[model samples]
Target: MKVNPTTLSWQAPTTNVDGSLIDYELEYEVGIAGDSTEGDYAPLATIPGQLRERETYVAPIADLPLDHGEHTIALRSFDKAQPDRMSEWSEPVTFMLATVPERPLELRVT
Candidate 1:
């Protein structure tokens, strides 16, 4: 994805019977199919209050375990009433981790 993970936001699932969603868990692995497990994937943030259809996760870059390179991102919705009861993780999203490019200097017209 071209968008930044730190600024990434997603919508909640409607076709789930996992009661009410409490939080949206964002996890990521270093490489493709690296691992989506709790230990393998470093949890970025756990967003609470699932009242809104969508939410924006403010995960600082410093929180990310990976500094750079391709990675896999996945999301899981946790049940509100029951913490253990949660929905399955959504399909993984392929993303590239790179440093923000510096701004150009000395602009000139051709």
Candidate 2:
């Protein structure tokens, strides 16, 4: 919300249907959907091989800055092992930014 310019806090991915939830992976991309020639997904940031399943993982948005529009963040579940066994990225979460409106030309009292 509000074009998260600061760190984004998200709940760790819940238990997977297969029952393997060791580490968490987060990736984000900031841009218009139509701009992408291949796919909408862009590799913005990545946090892999993370340990300790914390309630919330704070990912800084400095790298992936968002403009006045909708953006999506994708996440996945990972297991603590070499060549990590990861799950397909979870449904992306969309965020929006508020646009600044033009100021009033003048004020009038009627």
RMSD of each: 5.9, 6.0
- In every candidate, how many clashes are there? 0, 0
Candidate 1: deviation at residue 59, Å? 7.0
Residues 24-95, candidate 1: write the lDDT tens digits.
442322222445454244455455543243353333444545558776766666655566755556566766
Compose the digit string of candidate 2's lDDT tens values, residues 7-110.
65556655666786544443322232345543355545455434234666665665564566676666554554432555565555667765667799889999
Span of ten consecutive residues with least summed lDDT in model 2: 25-34
The reply for model 2, stretches above 4 Å from the true place, is 14-16, 20-40, 48-54, 65-69, 96-110
Which residue pairs collide, candidate 2?
none
TM-score of each: 0.55, 0.48
Residue 86 in candidate 2, Cα distance off native in Å: 1.3
